[model samples]
Target: MFLDPLATPGFKRTLFNAIVAPRPIGWISTINAHGQTNLAPFSHFNLVSTAPAVVMFSCNTPADRAEKDTIANVRSTGEFVTNLVTWELREAMNLSSFNAPYGVDEFELAGLEKAPSLKVRPPRVKASPASMECKVLRIIEIEPIVEGDTTSHVVLGRVVGVHLDERLVDAHGHFDTLRAEPLTRLDGDRYAISGRTDMLGRPSPRRD
Candidate 1:
C-alpha cells in the first residue's frame, strides 16, 4: 500500500512514533540546585559517543505539568545519572515514571534504594546492575516545524563516573550481558528480556 505521510496517517506524529520500535529505556535521575530530586524514564535516549563517554536523552513537555523535572534539574545543576533497568526492577522503574510534583521523591515512591554517586549530586538506583553518573555537556531545544509547537529538548551528558554490581560482572572484568538480563521496552505496553544467541562474525570476502 502506498500512502503519503501527511495524508494517510492523518496524524504524522503518531505514525512516526510507532515506526521507531523498541527503543532502550533510560531511567534518569537528577537533583536540582535547590536539592530537590527527580526521576523519570525516557525511551528517546542512547549513547551518542564513546571518546568522552557521552549519552543523550530527550524529554518532552508533560501534558499536565508546566515543565519536566528531569530537564529542569539537569539544567539547574548540570548533572544526572542513567540507571540501567533489569528485568527484576521493571516494576520499580515504571513507578518512577509517574508524573508527580517537582518535589516528589521518586526513589522513595518506587521503593528503590539510592546509591550515592561519586561525582554527581543525583543518586543512582542501587538495585540497578549498572549506572552512569554524567555531567551535562549540552541541552539543545529541538525546534518544531511550525511555530507555537515546541519539540523535545535533547540533553547530552558526558559520563564521568560509573557504578557496577560485581555479581553482574565476570572475573575477567567484563559485563555479563546474559546474567544481567536487561529489560527493554517493546511496542506500546509490551516488554522483552535479552535472549541467548550465538555470536557470528561478518562474512569474509568471497574469492573470485
Candidate 2:
C-alpha cells in the first residue's frame, strides 16, 4: 500500500504514475529540426499554471537511450501541441503510442489527420476536440532515483493558443467535458473515460 521509492529494492520507476490513479493524457505532437513529426502520450502531464496558461509533461528517458523522440523534438524545436484524447480517438491514440523509430510520423502511423496550428509549428490533432498550442518555457531533467537509471525531462510550456470544438461550447463558453469524452490514463493497461472516476459516477451523459 505504502512505498518508499528511493528505498524499495526493484521499485518500478513508473509505479507512481499508477499510484496517482487516473491521470490526464497529454497527447503531445511535435516536429523535429528536420521537420519529422512525432506524437506520443504522456500520463505525467497536467496544467501547472493558470493565469499564463502553462502545462508540463514528464518525459522519462529510456534506459537504453539518451532521450525519447518527444523530448528530443521538443528540445530541438521549442514547441509542441497537447491534443486531448477522446473516446472516439482511443484506438488512434493507442496506435500513436507505438514505439516507432526516431523519424516516424505518428500522425500517419495512427492514421489521423493533422490540422494547422495557429501559433506553433507543430500540427494539432484534427480529430481531437481540443488542442493547446504551446511554446516551451523550460525543460528540467530530474536526478534519477535509482542512480543508474536516467530520470525524466520535465518540459514546461506556455499555452499561447487553444483550439476548441465550437459545438462542445455552451452559451457561457464553457467547453463540455461529457461531450468530449476524454480518456485518462490508469495503471498498467487500464484507461478510464473522463468524468467516470472524479465525479463519483454518472448515469447517461451529463457534464458535471
Candidate 3:
C-alpha cells in the first residue's frame, strides 16, 4: 500500500526506520562537564567517512524531556566514544538504554568495566571488541515540524583514536568479522548476528 507521508500519521517514520533494516547499533558513552557519565544505545548511527574517520548518530528528544544524556554530554564536552556491541555484551548494552536520571553512572549500573580512552575523557566499554574515540565535529539540529516538539540532532564526530581487542585481529593485521561477532538491531526488540552468508566482495573495476 502506498501512502503520502504528509497525510500518514507516524507511518512515514515507522516505514523509514524499518526499511533501513539491520542497522549497526552504537552503544555511545559520554561524560558531562560535572563528570556525570551516561550511556545509551542508538540505532540511527553509521560511519559517514573514512578519510578523516567520521561517524554520526541521531538523537531524538522525548515528548516531555529535553535532549538525551548522550546528546547533552557530547554537547558539553564535544567528545564521546562509539563502542561496538557484540553478542556477549548485549545484556549490559540493553541495560544502558534505560532512561536513568542525571549523574547516573550507566557503566556502574550495567555492571560493565570501563577502559580508559587514549584521546577522550569518556571511557570505552572494556567488553567491547572495538571502540572509536571521537571528538564532536558538528551537531546539526533537525527542525521540528510541529510547535513545542523538540527536534532530532545529528552529531558528527571525528575518530581520533581506536581500540581493538587483539583476539579480533589476524596476523596480517586484518580484523576478523567472525571473531568480532558484532550484533545488529532489527525491527522491534529483535536483534541479529552476521553470518557467513552476509559476507560479500566486490570485483575490481576493469580498465578496458
The best candidate by lDDT is: 2
lDDT of predicted model 2: 0.90
- Show the colliding residue pairs in model 1: none
Which sections of candidate 3 miss by over 4 Å? Answer: 9-12, 146-150, 196-208
Worst 10 residues of 3 by lDDT: 8-17
| Tens-digit per-residue lDDT, 19-108, candidate 1 | 686577899999988787788888888999899899999977767665699998988899999999888888998899887888899999
Please give each candidate's TM-score: 0.90, 0.89, 0.92
| lDDT of each residue in 43-135, candidate 2, tens digit only | 889999899899999977886678999999988999999999998898999999998988999999999999999899999999899999999
RMSD of each: 2.1, 5.5, 2.1
Candidate 1's C-alpha lDDT?
0.85
State the TM-score for model 2: 0.89
- Give the clash count for each candidate: 0, 0, 0
Q: In model 2, state the lDDT of residue 37.
A: 88
Q: Where is model 2 more than 4 Å wrong at Cα?
A: 10-14, 195-208
* Model 3: per-residue Cα lDDT over 1-208, one tens digit each: 8887666666545566677878899999899999877789999999999998999999788754687888889999999999999988899989998888888999999999898998899999988989999999999999888654468999999999999899888899898876688889887788889865664688899999
